[model samples]
Target: MPAPELAAVPGSQDPAPAETGTSRPTATSTGAPGGDAPLGFTGAGTGEVSSGSPDAAAVEEPAAPAEEAPPSTQDSPVGSEPAEGAPATREEVPTAAPTAPAATPAEPTATPAEPAGSAATTSEAAAPAESTAPADSAAPTDRAEPTDGAPSSEAAAPGEAAAPGEAAAASEAAAPTDGAAPTESPTPTPGPRPAPSPSPRPRPTPRRQVPTPAAVAPAAAAPSVVAPVDAHDAAEAAAWGRVDDDGTVYVREATGERVVGQYTGADTEEALGFYVRRFLDIQAQLALFEARLAQITPKEIDQTLATLTEALAEPAVVGNVDGLRERLEKLRSAAGERRKQAAAEREAARAQAVAERTVIVEKAEQIAEQDPARTQWKQSGQRLRDLLDEWKTAQRTGPRLDRPTEDKLWKRFSHARTAFDRHRRQYFSELDATQDQVKAAKEKLIARAESLSTSTEWGRTAATYRELMDEWKAAGRASRKDDDALWARFRAAQQKFFDARSAQNAEIDAEYGENLKAKLALLEQAEAILPVTDIKAAKAALRPIQDKWDEAGKVPRADVQRVEGRMRAVEQAVRDAEQAAWKRSNPETKARAEGAAAQLESAIAQLEEDLAKARNGGDAKQIADAEAALEARRTWLDQVQRAVHE
Candidate 1:
C-alpha cells in the first residue's frame, strides 16, 4: 500500500477516491460531493484559466497554491456498511502534499489511518489475492519519500507496511489471485492523523471502473480559490478530459488521450469541469479574432495563428481539441482569402490611379498644343498648374502605380507644362514687341497731326491733310484701347483744321456754287466731243472748253474732285484725238504703217504655203500653227489699213 494524499474513512471498504497535486489556478473549494469539490476560481494565476483550454489561454505564469483539503469530500450516510458480498478493501487515500514531511509511522489498528503521501487500495477478499491496476494515464504521479532502502510492488504482502514511492493503480478494483488460498492481510500501520469529515462507503470497482459521482462540497473554509465556470461547460469538459479513480486526469486528443496532470480537486467531474470552462474562454478569444479578421492584416493573422497553434499543440484543457484546430484552419483559410481580396482592391486602386494620371497628362497636353494666338494664357496656364496639383495629390493618397507607368505619365505632364510656359512667354514677348512698334508709329503720326492742326493755307493745307489721312489708313491698328485713344486725339486735331477750312469755304461756297455750275456746263460741252470723227474739230472744241473750265475754277470743297474729274475726261478725249491726228500727219508714221501692212500681207501668203505643205505631210500640229499665224497676220493687216484710213 502506498501513502497517497487521498486519505480514507475508518473501516468501510470500496477504495476511497484520490487527492491530486495540480498547478491549477487559485480557487475557493465548493467541497461538494464526488472527491474534490467545485472551486471558486480566483483568476489570480493559472486556475484563472477557464474550464476549457487552460494551456491554450493567455494566463499568468504563476500557479495557484491549494487553499484547503478536507480528508473526505463524500459525506457517509449514518450506519452505512460495506456491501455483504463485496471484498473488504481499504482504500488508502492521499491526505498530504508530496512536499509534506514524512509521516510518523503509527502503531497498527483495526482501521488504519491512511498515509499522507501516495494513494493505495488493499483488497482483502476471502479468495486469493488478485490486484487490479488500470491502464495508467499519462497523468503525473504524486508519491511519498521512501523509508526503506529496497523497492516494493504496488500490492504489498501480508504484514508489509505501505511502501513509499509506489503509485496506486487508479480507478481499478482488486481481488485475491486465482487458485491461491485466501490469506488474511495485515492491517496497515496508522499514519499521520488527517483532519477529515466522515464519508460514504466506496463501491467496489471493476478493472475498468465506471464513472464516479460528482464531487461533494468541501468545508466552507476550504482555502483554494477557484473561478467558477458556467455549468454549461461540464458537457464540453467531458468531451475532452476525464479523471480515473486514482485521480489521474487526462485530456482526449485526436491522436489519443494524453496526461494533463492529476485533478487534485473534489472529483472527476469537478476536475473536468474546471478545464472545460477554460476551453470556453479560449473559444471566446477565437470568436473575437474572427470578428477582427477584416481589420487585422494577414501578417497579424499569421502571428495569431502561430500563437494559437502553439497553444493548441499541448494544451491543458478539456473540450473539442480537434474542433479548435479546425477553427484555426478556418482562420488560416480566411486570412488567405483576405489577402487575395486586398490584393484585388489594391490592383483596382492602382488602375484608377493610372487612369487619373493619364487624364492629367492629356489635359496638360491639350493646354500646351493650343494655338498661341488664340489661347487664353491666364486660364489655360492656371489649369495646367491645377492638374499638376491633382497629380501630386493622387500620388500621395492613391495606391501606387508601377514606377514605369507613373514616370511615363509624369514626363508627359511635365513636358506639356514646360512647353505651355515657353509658348506663353514667347507669345507675350512678340506681342510686346509689336505693341511697342505700333505705339512708336502712332506717336509720330500724332505729333505730325498736332503740328498740322493750326494750318490756315486752305488749298495747300487741304492737299497735305489728304496725304496725312491716306498715310493713317495705310498704318495698321494698335491694341484696341491704345488705338482707340490715339485715334480720338488724331480725329480731334484733324477736325479742328477741317472746321476752320469749312467755315471759310461756307462764305466762298455760294460763289463756288456758281463756279461749280459753270464747270459742270463746260464738262457737258467737252464730253460731247468724245465721239468726234474729225480730229481737228474735236481738238479745237476741247481746247476752248478746257480754257473756259480753268477760268470757272474753285468749286465747293466736296464738289471739287467731282468737277475736276469731269473736266479731265473731256480734256483727255481731246488730247487722245489730237495725238492720233498729229501721228497721221507725220510722213514717217504713214510710211511705217504702210510698211507694216505690206509685211503682214507677205507673211500671210508665206503662212498659206506652209499650211498647204503641212497638210500634205499630215503634220496636224504644224498645220494648226500655220493656220493660226495666217489668221493673226490677216487681222493685223486689217487693223493697219483701218488706222491709216481714220
Candidate 2:
C-alpha cells in the first residue's frame, strides 16, 4: 500500500508535508501534575494529535509500478514526488520538492528503513498552540525549506525524485497544510486505533529513545499511524511540525522550520507529539518558576530569568513560544521590584546588626572605664570576653556593615578591651606590691602579739595584744592564699600564749578567792559597829577589822575593786564618828560656848535688876523687856553648862 497525500494548509502557497494532530494542554504550574517529575504532564492536554504519533517508514524491495496512475486521491504536501509517468490518483506519492534530488527510476536500489514517527500537528496553521511533546524534544530544525533542497512549495510533480529507495509508492507523511482547509482523505476513521506493537532493534545512537515500530495501522496505504489522537490536537500540531518519508522530524516556528531531532521508530503523529510534549514541559517550568518568585532572592531571580530568556530565545519544543516570552518579560519587570524590596530588607538587617554591635562595644567601654580598685576584675573580665565573642559572631554571620562604620566600631571595641586588660594588669601589679608591704607589717604585729602572749604581766600583756590586733586591722591584706596561711600561724601563736596566761590567771583567782571571802567577813563585822554611835568602840572594832583585812592579803584582780570598795565604806564610817567626837571635845569651841553663856547670863541679871525696879515703880514696858531677857539668859546658861561639861 502507498502512503496517503497531505492536504495543504489554509494560508500557505504550498501544501504541508507528513504530519498529524497535536495534543491539547491541560497541565499548569498553578495546578501541577500529580508527581515530582514536572515535565510529564498527564491531563486533558496530554491527548496526542490525530493518531497519537508520527508515521514510521515501512521498508520493502524497490519495485517500479507498471500502472500510470496511483490510488491516492489527495493533493501533494511538502515531499510529494511520484514515479515517472505514474497515475495522478496514486495512494502514495513522493512528496519531494522541486529542489529535492530527482529520482532515477532507471536504476533502482534498496535503503534500510530508518526509525521514524508520525508528525502530529494542527489544521489551523495560522497560530501555534501549546505543544504536547515530551519535555526533551529538540529545537525546531524543519527540512521543508528550499535551502535543504526541500522547497517550501507543492510536492514534486509526477516525475520529481525523493531520496534513494524512497519511492512515491509508500512514501510521504499525511500531514495537514496551511495552504488550504483540511479535507477528508482515505484515512482510518476517527475511532479507537490498535496500539502499535513495538519490536526492538539495534540503533546507532541514543538520540531520541523510542522503541522501533514493527507494525502499521489499519490504513495500509498510510505510511504510519499511532494510537488514537484528539482531532483538536491534530489541528494545532499541523501548525508546528511535519514528518518526511525517511522518518525525519522537524518543528515549525516563526523563524521557520529547523530540524530538531529524529525518532523514526514510530509514526508521524508520535514524532510531532514528542516535540509537543517538550513545549508543555517548558510551560510547566515557567509556571513553577513564577510560583517560586517569593522564595528566591532578587539575585537568584535575575539569574534564573537570564537562563530562562536564553532558553526561550531558541526553544526546541513546538508551541506558542511568544506567550512564554511575554510571560518571562513580565517576570523580569516584577524582579526589579523584588530587588528593591530585598535592598530595603538588607538595609534594615544591617542597621539592626550595627545597633547590636554598638551595644556590645558600649558595655565593654563601661567595663573598661570602671575604677580598678573597686571593679570586680574576675566577673568584669569574663563579661568583656563575652562581649568580644558577640562582636566576632556578628562580624562573621550578620549583614556586612560599611567599611568606615565597621572600622570605627572595631577600633572602639578593641581599645576598650585593651584598656580593660591593661587596667586589670595594673591593678594586680599594684595589689602585689601593696600585699607585700601589708604582709611585712602583719608579720611584725604577729611577732609582737606572740611576744606579749606569754608574759606573766597579764594586764600589760593583754593591753599590748589589743594594740597589736588594732595594728593588724590597719595593715590591710595580702594575697588570699598567703593571708590565710599567715593568719593561721599568728592565731596559733596567740592562742598558745593566751592559753598559758588563762591557766595562770585561773590559779591566781583561786588563791585570791579565799582573800575575797575573808575581806567580806571583816566588812560585815566592822559595819555591825552601829554607824559609830559609840566612837571609841567603833574605833577599836575598826582597828581590829582593818588589821584582819590587811592580813587577808590581795584578792583576785576581778574582785579587787568590789572588796576594797566595801572595806573602805566601813573604815570611812568609823573615821567620820571619831572626827565628830574630836570636834565636840575641842578646847576652843568649849571655851567659846562657856563665854557666850556667861555673857548671856550677865545681860539677864542686868535685865532682872531693871525689871525689879520697873515692877517697884509699876512700868509695864520695862517689866515685859526684863522678862524676855531673863528667859534668854537662862537658856544660854543651860547650854553653856552642858558644853563645858561635854
Candidate 3:
C-alpha cells in the first residue's frame, strides 16, 4: 500500500526560494530529547526576509507561498506540504507553513545551517535538523523528520535578498508542529540529518548572593530553556552565546558577535560553562563589592571598582554582557554613594578623636599647675603619665589629627611636664638645704646638753641643760636619716644629766645620816638639865650640851625638829634658876639695913639721958619729947635687926 497521498493544486508557480542571504538559526542541543530537552522551532514566519532586521519580519505576509514546495502531491503524505504548482490555501496549509523556509524546486542543494541562536532573539532557536534540509532535495516532505516544520529560507533565489528581519521572523516561525505524522520520505534518498552535537546540560542559574539594595529588588536569573531551566531563561542564555561542536564559544552583544574563547577537548556545554563561569566570576566579584560597600574604605572601593570595570569591559567569558554592563553601571552608581558616606564617617571620627586628645592634653596641664609644696607628688606624677598614655592610645587607634593642633597640644603638655619637673627639683633642693641647717643646729644643742650632763653645779647646770632641750624642740626637723641620729644624741645627753643629779642626791643623804645620829645623842644629854635646883650647876651642864649640839653636823631633815625641841626645854629650866639667885644676893638691901640700925641706937641713948634730967627738974614736956624720939628709934632698930637676922 502506497502511503496516503494528497492531490496537487495546479497552476501555482514553484514557491520562490527564500530571499537570498537569509540565514536560519538552528537550536543548540543540550542532550537527548527525552529528559527535558527544549522542543525545536514549531513553525516559520509569514514571509521571507534577511536575517539582520527582526522587527520587520514579524508582519503578516499572507500572499507569500511556502519558500520551498513539497514533493509533487503524488509522493507526499496527506497534509505534509502544500499541493504542487498551486499556492496552498491558508485553510489547507499546516499552521506552521506560514513561517516555513523556501520550498523552491530550482535549486536543490541545501545551504549550511546558521548558528543555533540569533543576535536579537525573543525565543529559542529551532533544532538543527528541524529547520534545515538534510541535503539537496526537491520536496519539503523529504526534509528531516521530527523537525521545527519550518521550510528552509537559506534556499532563497539568487540576487533576490530581502531585509535582515527575515531571520528573526523565520526564527519565530520555526516552532514545531503537530500537523504531519512523522513519515520517511519515499523520493530521492536524502542524507541523514547530522546528529545534534552533544552539549553539557546547562546548570540552572543560581540566585545572586548579594543582598538587595534598600531601594532595589534582586535581579532575576537569566531565563533558559535548557534542562532544569525555564523557557524564558533558555531564551535569555541563547541571546548571549552559542557554542559549536568544535569547542568554539561565541558571545553576542549589542556591539556585535565575537569569539570570546575556546575549550578544546571539552563538550559544548562544558566549554560554554567554562566561559560562563568567567561571567559568573564577574557577577560574584560584583556581589562581593556591593557587600563590602559598607565594610571597606572608600579609596579601596574606588580601586576595586576600577579593577572590576576593567574586567567587565573586555571580559573572558560569554553571557548576557549588556545586562552585566547595566548591572555594573548600577553598582558604579551605588559605589559613588557608598564612597561619600564612608568619607563623612571618617571625618566625624577624626573630629571626635581630636576632642578626646584635647581633653587628655588639658588634664595634663591641670596636673602641672598645682602647687609643688602641697601637691601629692606620687599621685600627681602618675596622673600625668596616665593622661599621656591616653593621648598615645588615641593617636594610635583614632583618626589622624592635624599637625598644627597636635603640635600645639603637645607643646602645652610638654611645657607643663617640664615646669612640674623643674619645680619639684627646686623644692627638693631648698628642702635639703633647710634640713642641713636644722641638722647642724641640733648637733650644737646636743653638744651643749652633753657638757652640762657632767657638771657638778647641779641646779644651775640642770637649768642650762633644760634651756638646751627647749632649743632642740624649737629646731625644725631634718631629713629622716639625719633627724633620727640627732634626736638620739640629744636624748642621751639629757638622760646623763638627770642620772648624775640623782647620784649626787643619794651621796648627800648618806652623809646626812651620821649627822642625824650625832644630833640625836646631844639632844638627849641637853634634856637632862630640866628642873634645876642649883642654877649655876644647871647652867654649866646646859652650856656644854648646847655647844656640843651646835658642833654636830647637819641633821637629817626628818629629825631636825625633834632634836631642837629638846634643847629648847633645857634652856628654859636654867633661866628659872638664875632669876631666883639674883633675888637673894641684892647689895642695896644690906646697905639700907646697916644704916638704919646705927641711927636708931644713937637716938635711944640720947632719949634715955634726957628723960632722967627732966625727971629731976620736973620738966614733963622735955621728957615727953625725949620719950617719943626713943620709942620711934626703938621701932626702927627692931626692924633693922629683923632684916639682919633673915
Clashing residue pairs in all predictions, respectively, total 69, 95, 39
For model 1, the local distance difference test gives 0.52
User: Cα lDDT of all candidates, in order?
Assistant: 0.52, 0.52, 0.50
Query: Which segments of candidate 2 are over 4 A away from where they belong?
Result: 1-269, 450-454, 519-551, 557-646
lDDT of 3 by residue, 226-269 (tens): 22223354345555887766444688889887665433333465
Score every model by TM-score: 0.42, 0.50, 0.42
Predicted candidate 1 versus true structure: per-residue lDDT over 130-216, tens digit per residue: 111111111111233323331221122111222211112111112111101111112222223223324321111121221221111
lDDT of 2 by residue, 331-413 (tens): 88888878888899999999999999999999999999999989999999899889988998999999999999999999999
Minimal lDDT window, size 10, model 1: 57-66
Better of 2 and 3 by lDDT: 2
Please give the lDDT score at residue 440 for candidate 3.
Answer: 88
Using lDDT as the measure, what is the rank order of every candidate, best first? 1, 2, 3
